[model samples]
Target: MPEPITQTEYWNGDVGARWAAMQAELDQVFAPLTAALLDGAGLRPGERVLDIGCGCGETALLAAARTGPGGTVTAVDVSRPMLERARARPAGGSPIAWIEADAQTHPFAPEHDVALSRFGVMFFEESRTAFANVRRALRPGGRLVVLCWRALAENAWVHVPRDAVLTVLPEPAPSPPGGPGPFRFADGEALVDLLGQAGFTGAAVAPIDHPVAIGADAEAAARFAATVGPIAGLLREIEDPALRERALAAMRQAMPAERPVRLGAACWLATAVHPG
Candidate 1:
């Protein structure tokens, strides 16, 4: 993975706190989608599941309920501030074990039955290596499932705001034609291929057009974006003061009054069985 440009600032600074709070808001916007991201996890009554980059613990908490009393769920993330919110969450079931480690290189046990990531695998500088680490963390018969964006054009939530932010900032690191944006795993085929290279088979991707319900006002939404999510930081690079204001202003106006705006976001709901 590309070395984090600002590891310390990104991980433990105000940006982190802003993001945690921002995620809290955005997750609420994505609550419904969260349920579907976990649609087929098959979190049986007594099985274990690992939620990688388990943002805000939404899916992790859901998996915990599925596991019931005999089962366990371990949720891991790279951010302490984010995990703090997860850890401090009111008791829903068994307290989820929260681990603060890079999902790419954490020393993970290989006994878990399933490994899952929801909109969390895209930040890696090196996708192959990250998945390789995740593969090593799973048992021989385990499965890996992930949900990522489809393409930039498919979703206004991403591209629209991205267009707004980038206009305000300096050009970012070059991204792929259709991907490597914040939502790198947008291509299901690409994910399947990568998983195969990482030594897993039966990788499959399913499309999910989740209508996101954003905040009631544009300013609220922009605050959420500029502070916590990826767009704001990207916009910070814009040296042209007028362009920056216009871009951010555009994002605010982009907010939809109707909840669940039918913005197309491809959720590559993929699962690959570990080769025994």
Candidate 2:
């Protein structure tokens, strides 16, 4: 069998392309969560910021606006497609450097006032080492703020459709323990402990729950769920077109009747301080 694909390869492949194409829609769906993360970050004008896993540059652009023209933003991601999409967008705030590099090992200048991620951070192959690298990039007492999914069960926007699809396909094998995946840090205590291990201080996590519209209708919602997020990952492995269609149908049938199907999203707003 071929060697397993690395996270860099995974994101740079078709997954990245899909995300690049759906950037606007994904941003709209997660707008509330983005707001919560930015508010929690408390970015100030002229504060240099490091945006980790800055896919399509939504958080980075918004952060730039908050920090204004005097500030600078280093937005890093492994996916070239997403970075290209981000670079193509209209930017009106601080200067942003959209670098197609892995944040886990990037040699970021040690001058940022804050490090931020929106649904990033969780994909690190070495979670502790990655955060430690981020910590090293921050100045004394610099803050790290991120939004990560809380748990599969807690996130109805994912699990509801996931369960629906699973009815048609077998459950995929569980990810390796403490492995890199969306819900890797679902346990708040475990996440805080990892931050402490990475030499961060005063680590804290708070739940930020909100209703996110997945699509305009059941069909749209089904397509949205099957085209992106965790469910998309699951469907990507299936080679049989007929079976895949069945799974999509299940997802459509599972959606609520609301004109714009909305589902609850649960996430943790984790924050930490870098020791000088």
Those runs of model 1 whose alpha carbons end farther than 4 Å from true positions after fitting are 1-9, 164-173, 176-181, 238-245, 254-262
RMSD of each: 3.3, 0.9
Where is the poorest 10-residue window by lDDT in model 1?
Answer: 257-266
**On residues 76-194, what C-alpha lDDT tens digit does candidate 2 reach at each position?**
99999999999999997899999988888989899999999998899999998999999999999999999999989999999999999999999999988887889999999999999
- Per residue, candidate 1 scores C-alpha lDDT tens digits across 1-276 of 775453324656766676676666767777666777677666677777888888667788888887777777889887788788777776465447889878778888887888887777876656788888888887888888877777667776666677766654555776555333456776677778988998888888877777665545677666556654457667666778887678778777666665433344546678888887
Candidates' TM-scores?
0.84, 0.98
Pairs of residues at least 3 apart in sequence or in different chains that clash in candidate 1: 1-125, 1-126, 2-125, 19-228, 149-186, 168-238, 169-238, 170-237
User: Would you give me the overall lDDT of model 2?
Assistant: 0.94
TM-score of predicted structure 2: 0.98
The lDDT for every candidate, in the order shown, is 0.72, 0.94
lDDT of 1: 0.72
Q: How many clashes in each candidate?
A: 8, 0
The total of clashing pairs for model 2 equals 0
